[model samples]
Each structure stands twice: as C-alpha cells, then as structure tokens.
Target: VFCMKGDYSFERIVSSDVDCINLKDPVPLLYLKDHPGLSYNDSSYSYGESLSEFLRKKDVGNYSCYINANSPLIIRKCPYDPYKHHGDDNGKVMKNCRDNGYYHESRDGACYLCRLEGKCGCEHYGFETFINPQKTNETGRVSACGSDHVIFSDDIYSGVEVIYNSENGLNEILYLDPHGHKVKYGMSGF
Candidate 1:
C-alpha cells in the first residue's frame, strides 16, 4: 500500500490493490536508516518521522513518501469530502435530497432551480422586465455593475424635446410630477 503524510492532518493511503497493512503502527527508524541507496535529504523523508510526531504534525501541507519497492512509492493529495461522501458508490452530489434540495453536510448547497436563477435569469423578460426594470432610476438610467457611467436607459418617453440650450448642446428637460413620477412630453428632438 502507498502511504504519505497528507496536508498534516492524517496519513493518506492510496492503493488499487486491496491489501491489509496496519499503517497506524510505528515505522521503525532502523528500517529507513539502513537504506543507503535511498536519500534522506528528500522532502519525502518527513513521512519517516515517528508515528506520534507524524500524527501531531498533521495539518494542511503537501508531502511525499518512498517505499523500498520496485515501483517508487507514490504520494497524492487526498480528495477532501467535508460531507463524508468519499466511499459512495453512486457519484451523486447528495445521497438523498434534503429540504434545501441538497445534503445537509454540503455547504451553500441549494435547489438546482434556485442556483440557475441566481447565476442567470431563466427567462429573457425575467431579467429585462422584472429584474433590470427594478434597478432603473427615475430618469430611466442604470449604472452597470462593473462600470462608472450609466450604460442603459429604459425611458418611458422615447420621443422627448430638448428644452434648454447649453454651451455644449441642447439639454433635455426631465419633469417630475407631484407623486414623484417622471413626466415626459412628446415634442420630438430640438
């Protein structure tokens, strides 16, 4: 069996061939010390520490290991499953759907429909009418999420007049009613 110190939390064992090896047992230093061909200067030597020290130093860190076998021993980062689904036969996200539509152990997991809607509005008008319209201001101006300037206008009045003359150009008039609703006049350009 191939074994290595994983990220400093536990010993990682990866092997396709099923064989029982009590890795929890302490690896005698004498066994490794007498191996002249094997170099101790390599990072893999860290796994050679006493069983107690190896267990104590377990945390999040990369590690390597060497065995006196023909095929050089391999060490790999263990796949972490906070939900404890590592040995599951079926590769489903959750064993069974819960109230939130995902396993309780999974973090931030929710219904697929909710996730899709959050990522992108499902309907074309759902984004334009219900979502985007709510974000517009009185002048029908909307500031883009990532930009400084307003990039879109859904003004109710598409044809309006330029009332005042300015040094730059003709300035359009935006009138507001008593109820705080913008009033638009149809007078066509300047």
Candidate 2:
C-alpha cells in the first residue's frame, strides 16, 4: 500500500507478514479539481481536518472542494461564496460519477451508487429504497416496502448481506434479515 505524505509525496510499504500494520497517513481517497489550490477530506478519508476548516485556512479563489454527503469517498466542488450549495445549509452535494457531469438518478426499482470508474453503469453498489410519490396518490406505493440492497464486493455472487432502507417519501421501511424475512420500521427510524 502507498500512503501520501504531502501534496505529491508518497511512501510505499511492502509487507509479507499477515499481521503487519502501517499507521502512516493515507492518500486522499478522492480529488475534486475545479482549479489547483483547493483540496478536501471527508470523515472516511482519515485526514485530520474538516472541509469547513480547510476552506477557512486557505485563500480559495473562486472554487473549493467539500465532502459530498451521499458518499464520503466523493469530494464535491462549489463556488466559494455563499458558504455552500444553494439552499442546502448542510452542503450536501450529490455525486456526479458520469463524464458528462451529472448524477445517476434512482430508477428501475433500485438506488445506485456509482462506481469509481466514471460513466459506466453502477457495478459497485445498489439499493432498493423508498421512491418519491409523484402525486398524493401514487401507484406502487406500498404501505410497507422492504429493500433488496445489493453490494457487489468482487463483482460476483459472494455477498455480506445487510439491511437498510433510506427514506425518500414512502411511509415505512422494511429490512430483510439473513433468512429473507421482513423487519418493518416506521419512517421516523430511517
């Protein structure tokens, strides 16, 4: 594994023992470049800093990078003025994993998390969560709908099954147990 030291410096570590551990600083998992002067870190990136603090310290000209809330591995770029993306005080930027600078919308009865490779179909992770009702009365609106979340760990059938349903607009979330039984929860718990 290789860990980053500074902006461009890296340290390479090679180990044979199974229990060997390297505690050095890791490379930033992702980079969002609008210009050249700004960088970002998320809770998952292990950088001992926050986006709010990093922006405060540097003289970011017109653009800055902040952690995208949808996924920690994604870093989103924004205009420096107005503190954050328009109308969103949490600075929750959506992921644009396509080359055309757009995000993949939830469709086909599943929620998709884009892969590291840009513009390809979501082969990395997917979820079956609540869908927003188009109107006050929407069809396929189940009083209780369970998700069929799928994670392609190695692009194979091997999986570590878990349960979850993100709230979009449905009334309740249903999680599946290891035995494929439904476990229900109200919208508040989601």
Worst 10 residues of 2 by lDDT: 94-103
Model 1 alpha-carbon miss at residue 147, Å:
56
lDDT score, residue 56, model 2?
30
lDDT of 2: 0.23
lDDT of 2 by residue, 13-54 (tens): 776533111221111232223223323343223222332233
TM-score of candidate 1 on Cα atoms, chains taken together: 0.13
User: What are the models' TM-scores?
Assistant: 0.13, 0.17
Candidate 1 per-residue lDDT over residues 1-190, each given as its tens digit: 4344765454556756432121111122322334344322211222232322322233211101111211102122123244334213332222121111121111212222322333222222211100011111123221111100011111121211122222244222221122211111111222
Runs off by more than 4 Å, candidate 1: 1-28, 45-77, 82-190
**Winner by lDDT:** 2
lDDT of 2 at 69: 12
